[model samples]
Target: MLPTNSCSSPTMSSPELKKVTVSLPKRLDRSSERWHHYLTIDLIWYVLGYTLFHPWTSWILVLCLRAQYTKYHAPEMKIAMAWAMLMSAIGIFHIFSERLAFGSPREVDLSDEVIVITGGVDGLGGLLAETYGMRNANVAVLDTKRVDDEEAEEKGVLYYQCDVSDAKQVEAVAAEIVEDLGPPTILINNAGIAHTKSILDTTAEEVEQTFRTNTLSHFTTLRIFLPYMLREGRGTIVTVSSVLGHLGAANLSAYSASKAALLALHHSLRAELAQNPAAQEIKTILVTPGQMSTKMFVGVTTPSNFLAPVISPAEIAKSLIRMIEKGDSGELAVPLYAQYIQILGALPVGMQAIIRRWSGVDTAIAKAGLVKKDTSEKQ
Candidate 1:
């Protein structure tokens, strides 16, 4: 038997509920930047891929011709059939190409995996960390920046203050992560810094630091955390480089060089893993994004917005998360131009020069006043 309060029915006052306002950070609105923002080449290509260029859509034209009682040998009917066959063949070739290049994807269970991300406090890494954290996965971030207790709790992630460039620091954090969460099964080497300075103006110390942070950090983290994955018999490694690695730009020598080294390192890592029976399940992903909309390149402008619009960190983060969840290993080059940048190098020298001049890749930093000055004083 439950006893009721006798005074409750005398007079009951309802408490007023106040509305709590939540403020979110302001994001850059690229849509309102220019009149042509809505008409990017990427948007045009995307539309074509889904409609005119799609195999099913191409076949639909043939069906429409048949429905109109057009003769099979008619020019329009023949053209439509041929186009449909071509589109279908291209689609089948793409499927085979992906299978040949990346092989079959492995099974991924997020609940059973521990992910370690470098530079996870901000930018692309931050977006990825928060995404995985939201899904309640075991995530550990190693960065020089420290996240406060309240923020860490709200984000559902563990932030370790450690410079991933240092091998000893990485090893220390690896031990702590193993104790706190578990052995790391996913490694995202995305920590990078850039100095927009010409090679002649850049100092040796600056170059060394750039390599240590951007390039050597991958090696350090891999050396420390990879053994755990090997012992565990499965893992995934993601290397975040830049498309500028393939196209060397003026006033970005150190950064481009560091990223280029990563391209080579990725292939080497994959080759080594392939040779090991225990590492067959250890997949690798390479990301080469072009001019992300992050603080690192705040003032740098894209030469051609129609062809090479600046990619958002959120966009890249989503693609990366998709690949990881699918357990697929492959290369990701965003922006339509990034995928074809390699072909630029193989073009005729005169054509390359003309394209470079028109694209302004070599002059963008200087024009934007982003080039760093040498500290040395003229005597």
Candidate 2:
């Protein structure tokens, strides 16, 4: 016979609730030797940006000088004011320049917008798809890899097995995506492949495959998805490229060349969009990440960790997601060095060669046994 009294059951107490703790992973303490060794030129530059190079901090010097009742004509006061004005002017100019270049941001409603991500089976693309899916956004992931139905459902993403490099497959996939998720308002053109052999060693077929996957895929996707965006009158296209595009590498000639084509394609897309009145709300984002710490470049070593650090796929994913959510057009070049890679081309040939050699660009692929014959999706 069961007891009828409610007192027989244990009552929840405040202390019991208070005793419950949500355990989290311990914070990383990077005060060790390896941590110090990991610090590099980019870290120093980042620190300076928030300190010495900060416009607000520069103005503080001018304010301090005035507080001391320093005359405007005085050398110290004049120098301080000049520095402050220069910094302030530069900062304001940058704001205006960005506004003028990109125009106003379009409204992004994830619930109403369809998101299409290519090469989303693994790596960076997978992260992006999963994130949007988790947010209850309509997400379609196109990849050659066959993901199980249960896994796709658990991740909240629609997976379509299609090779984006082939125009027929892309067209078919586009129809499927539209039918399933409505017209895609966000297109992340991330399909790519790399050929690591030297120019002389690379086969003709390998070069063709590299260009087809890395460069042609962009055109194919744009041709298929862009019409939908034009009809909708709003969208965002994100192009994933590489810093190697700006600096052609030795053993990575074909891979670098294919990426370089994306740089041009991005520019062309923007120019074409500018001419169209319907594309006023359409945004384009160019992602140029330097040596991402993915399996694509598993054993490759960066000459200087600090100067050209290996960026993680997660880092790139966050930036890409931010841009997409903001509904803005911009270029994202990570690891600091990628942003300044263009300058190397403007330098003297001998000087450029010296820098390349010093940076171990020519020897990096061969050194790490990175010449994998695998025909896999690129970064």
Candidate 3:
């Protein structure tokens, strides 16, 4: 192991950065030189938000109508004015609502922050850890997978081999991290695993293991690190959940249920922090992403690419880093569909059933060739 002082040194890139360079693999080529494929629901919504939904833009129409010799009470002039007033009211209400719910933003200085990311060896967690490391932040990664010492030095990431599911292991690592890189002020709880088994096919052990890794890890980490934040009076906790949590799937019952528990846990943590004066500056960010182009769900095809586009891990990382740096507490649900998934719960029971059926959420796992976990796959 390296000396404790070396833990806080300047960040470094992967070794391959110096010896070799490779072209980005062909994936979603934004530079495909096509135009029609750009037309999507998200793009339309963005355009409307700036041009039509903007209050200032709407008011400009009223000025134009008056310039054409329209009277104050003329139907077109009055309608335009009314629309502008309504949009302005909406904009003002949103501002107040956010302030009342989340309070003011906290000051963030990346140079002084120590970031601890669980499951940072791959997927979403890896992207985030790497990004912070690149920015020269003091970053510690906790994961089951082992990283070579040279690789860790190259990436400027301190890898701690510990399973977050074990409370004792987490506590031990917390002590080591404190001595190595000072207290961790930013915690990203993003470790997760999926077991694609039908409720009937899953065994007691499988269910327990799934919950331990996905759900209990949050509780364990909170108990271990919350005190550090309480004493320091500033921190950011990010919880990475899934869209499936809001809508439980058939074969993914265990996985979905575990993630669902986190949704409530996140709220509870926020409420507790709000009540504590010392914890006022501690921000909580919730990330509920849809089907991501990650290894965990590698082969699941999107039902509609336009409506529910598959997101890349890099996209999620960008949004997450933005939120953390801003020091704001909020919920981030990517893809338009995930943002509105909560509305399905408010619908009538009969309608909810019909929608779930139409979406084929229940059968997607089986159709995608998922199976129950065997003993050999338990890791």
Candidate 4:
């Protein structure tokens, strides 16, 4: 671990310094890329949001009509004015609804907060940890993966080698974190593992491992670390789930079930926190992202690039950081589809099945031949 006093040490170079020296990975080749890659529903929606849906943009349209000497009673002018008012009303209502649901956001000072991230050695967790470290936040990472002392020091993060799935290990690590950094006020539970196997094909051991890592780890961390937040009377707990959790796939039975459990857990955490008077300042953020370009889903392909474009870890991280800093409890669902997935469950059973089949939700893994085989097959 780097010395606690290393933050002020001039000898310790910033992690960004390594970025200058290290060669970055090459961008994906254009020849192999498809036209669909450049065009997605998300891109179109984003453009529409800024141009068509934006209140200011709507007003601009009205202004254009007026500039053209259109009378207020003219059909085009009336439509434009009505549209602008509707957009403005929607924007105002959205802000008011958010405030009503989450209450006021608490002030977040990065310097005063100690951030703890599980699975911080790699992927989204690593990205968040490094970002905070660069900002000189007291950052601690608990993961089974170990980072070398020099690299950890250079990154300005304390790496704790702990298997977060194990309650004992998490408890021990929590103690160390409390001692190293002050009691962690920001808890990011992003550690998860997946076994691409059918229910029958998945062994009990593998299923147990998946649950331990994905679901139980949240309980372990919360049980151990939540009291610290309670004592401090303020904290932000981030739960990273998956869109597949709501729409279970054929070959991802164990993985999906575990993530599904997290959805319930997140809501339970929020409800319980609401009951506690002292927990009013404790914010809970739930992140349900669609297929991300992380190593966990490296070979996995989305069924529809237009509908469910693969999200970047960086995008999710940015949203999480923003929510955490704003100290607001909210759900961060990416790829538009993820946000509205619950609507699928509300549809007719026959329609739901048809939609699922059309979306190729159950067949993606099997078609890709990425299904995990029995241990006997490997042997």
Q: For this target, which candidate reaches the highest TM-score against the unseen true structure?
A: 4
lDDT of 4: 0.90
Q: Is candidate 2 or candidate 4 better by TM-score?
A: 4
Question: Among all windows of ten consecutive residues in candidate 1, which has the lowest summed lDDT?
Answer: 24-33
lDDT value for model 3: 0.89
Q: Estimate each model's TM-score.
A: 0.89, 0.85, 0.86, 0.89
> What TM-score does candidate 3 get on C-alpha atoms?
0.86
- Residues 243-305, candidate 1: write the lDDT tens digits: 989988999999999999999999999999988989978889999999888998887788778
The order of the candidates by TM-score, greatest first, is: 4, 1, 3, 2
Compare the candidates by lDDT and give the number of the best one.
Answer: 1
Screening candidate 2 with a backbone cut-off below 3 angstroms (N, C-alpha, C), the clashing residue pairs are 40-306, 192-378
The reply for model 3, stretches above 4 Å from the true place, is: 1-38, 60-76, 373-379
Clashes of 2: 2
Could you tell me the lDDT of residue 79 within candidate 2? 85
lDDT of 2 by residue, 1-379 (tens): 9877565335545344456777655555445458767687877987888877789999888888889898989999888878888888988998889889999889998998999999998889988999888999999998999999999999999999998878999899899889888998899988877777877678788899999989999999998899999999999999999988888888899999999999999999999999999999999999999988776778888888867888889989988888888888999999898888898889999999899899998889989987656454432
Candidate 3 vs candidate 4, TM-score winner: 4
Candidate 4 residues 1-379, lDDT tens each? 7756525567676465543566555674346777767798888998999999999999999999999999999999999999999999999999999888887898899988999999998999999999999999999999999899999999999999999888998888888888888998999999999888877778888889999999999999999889999999999999999998999989899899999999999999988998899998999999999989888867677778888888899999998899999899899999989999999999999999999988888888877778877855321
> Between 1 and 3, whose lDDT is larger?
1
Clashing pairs in 1: none
Error of 4 at 111 (Å): 0.5
